[model samples]
Target: MTELLDATDSQTAMLADLVDSVRAVEETIARLSAVRDGMLAIASRIAVDVARQASHPDQGDMAVRSVAAEIGAAVRASDRTIERRMDAASWLVEAFPAVWAAQGAGRISAAHAQVIADAGAHLDHALHREAYAARAVEAASVESPNRLRRIARRIAEQFQPRTVTERHRDARELRRVWVKDLDDGMAELGMLGPAVLVHGMHDRLTRMARTITLENAQATKASTEETGEPDTRTTDQLRADLLADLVLTGSPVGHDSQTGVLGKIHARVEITVPVLTLMDDDPGASGSPPAELDGRFPIDTDTARLLAGGVTGWERVLTHPITGALLAVDRYRPSDQLSRHLRARDQRCRFPGCGIAARKCDVDHTHAASHGGETCADNLAHLCRRHHMLKHHSPWHVRHRRVGDDRGEHENDDTNAGRAGDLIWTSPTGTTYIDRPPQQNAVTFTEDNPP
Candidate 1:
């Protein structure tokens, strides 16, 4: 009974195997039929070429249009197959230097030889020769042409420049070393990009010019004294003294008015505020009435009034913690919450490649409102104007973490998060990439975590 059951089970298994084999054979037959038809068309076109060659004996043996068309059709029919063929040719050239050299002597187009040349460019000639031999041996051992071809093409591309512009730029930079020092510096300056470097140079020159002007002014003052006129304070020195006086002790006076002031006014005038001090009442000191404090101290009335207002209204606009050159306080109102958040997140712009601080950035909406995005904290990101514009207008996308996710999950998850959302960039060649989030440091952290 056991033997009979075993035989029955084997028979069933054999039947199933037979059915699978038949299906596979049918598929193969269909493929072959297609190939046969394509080959027949190619042969017909080749025959036409042969006839053309015979008819135009003096025209030189050029490829006939019909044959070219057929070849194009074949390539279009299977681009992957054509790529594999090219790859195979490349491998053959690498494996046999003599063959490559013969081909380079004008037997093939540069494109055909490039694949091999590129592969060899990655290594010293001797090592490349060895690699080619190893590849040949591997192909022979495996009996796989496609595998060998794929490996060769990949190796070639590893040494080839991805674009012409990159190659040209690299060559130019290499040649820069032989240039004159000033010329080399200028070239480096331009390489940094005109807009950035020019602005920076302008600022630096302005600072140096100001320093020179101050020095010249002081020297002029010394010369004038030597010539024996009035030894008056230099303009810069006088300005400095005035500024110091205003900072130390100036006060503002308010004028009563019913209606709000309008329009603009310009005027120049000067006023003096006497330095006042309380007198010490010492009966033991026998002296005449204490000399009056100097009452001829000159002050700019407009500046003094402005300073007084700043002292009185300081609490309303300026916070104790916020210290530095004062930026426009009003312009910052809309993004105050975002500023705080950015401080906590670290004040840097939250876009990869951007290091601008939150204070120098605009609060951008990760998900645009036109696309039904909300204006919540989770949807906001700090980005400098340049990066913000890139995100909004360029082929770049941004994504921020959802409210519920833990901070760690979002921390360096810029690409993944962007993919999960509607944010995805289609590159120029139609390839897609996710724009990464920016890194944060102390400034960004404080901006993100503002109290």
Candidate 2:
């Protein structure tokens, strides 16, 4: 194996040797991936066992949380993500033995197996699962995931015989919007719904922003900020402005007309700016230290000032003179000091991968109150509604222990100290995983130095 990596052997020997080495590595990766999938299959069985045991109140240790809680914590993955993998694994083993066999033989990768399993999931599991699996796997060998989806959809349409309108109606029932925080103080808003309706909205926005011409772009390039320039907006800029205009002011959309009704859109925005930066009075400022927006994304000092001017009666934020503790808000709906600290410290759900904003989560007792859990920071952590209920109703247990200097814990770090404390989650299966609080700090990265 070590000889395979030797460039001397590859460079001096026939090219076929190098090709063989590459194929060896690829085969090893495929086999490892297949083994992991097999483990996932075992996990799915454990989930079912835990779920069944928990459902029977007579079982002592097995009377635990939902299968998702146990397996999800054990794997340190999102509950939804684990559920999908389990569904894929279980479906392949039970309904599509041929595809699973192919995967085990390394003829198809794990991804290919999952694609085949997921594509046929909507079929009638009882009567048509075998039929669907047989058809889907035949194409799986010759097709990619995308093509498999098309093949499965075509097969499903034939077997189920649903009208296009009926399918559209069903798809509309699953419409939702979600937020994902990005690395650079930005976030993406994802909209999922009827494909045609969503795509049409984008098409309309694109058409509305198509007024920009090359001539106008050229004229604006030479124009200074001091000089009045022609409309030099790019396609994206125009589309954004159009969206803002329509939302902020109930204006009509598109060149002709749009499909949706307009209303006065009310929004709440929070920005925290350092006092000196807010006043533009900081002399040491070089690249303008960023301000916190919505307590998540960061923005330039100029953007902060602009937003500050637009809002009415901006709230003043104060910090402790020494430790930078957020001063108590005596006037702003007072609450328990510890609860406030917990809320701030846990900006979002504290579960391994759940990101529901903490403000929207329930302050859960790490140990059951009935089990003598106290209402202190160390005994508390934010769990979103689903997980909060999950912890209590199932066998999942949460424990918190200090990991760093107790005296140096930040004021907002109380619920768990963003990184100071270790929160251990024990699955029904008796596996433990730790969740670290989210914090922001500067990091430096340098590429390999050239020779």
Question: Where does model 1 exceed 4 Å of error?
Answer: 1-346, 393-395, 406-451
Per-model TM-score on C-alpha atoms: 0.24, 0.70
RMSD in order of candidates: 28.0, 8.1
Per-residue accuracy of model 1 over 1-451 as CA lDDT, tens digit each: 5764656777989988999998566545534433433444344445456666667542312223223222333333322233334344434443455434433342332233334344444344565555554453333333333444566556544534355466546545543222112321121112333345547745655565566567766887678455444435554555455544543454332442344232122222222111110122331152212211111122333344444344422211222232221122223335564445433343456544334545667877778888988876657667677556556544444466443433323222234433111223332223343333322110111465453
lDDT of 1 at 330: 27
For model 2, the stretches where C-alpha displacement exceeds 4 angstroms are 1-24, 53-75, 125-132, 155-158, 211-227, 244-265, 269-289, 293-297, 308-339, 367-379, 399-424, 429-437, 440-451
Best by lDDT: 2
Worst 10 residues of 2 by lDDT: 442-451
What is the C-alpha local distance difference test score of each model?
A: 0.42, 0.65
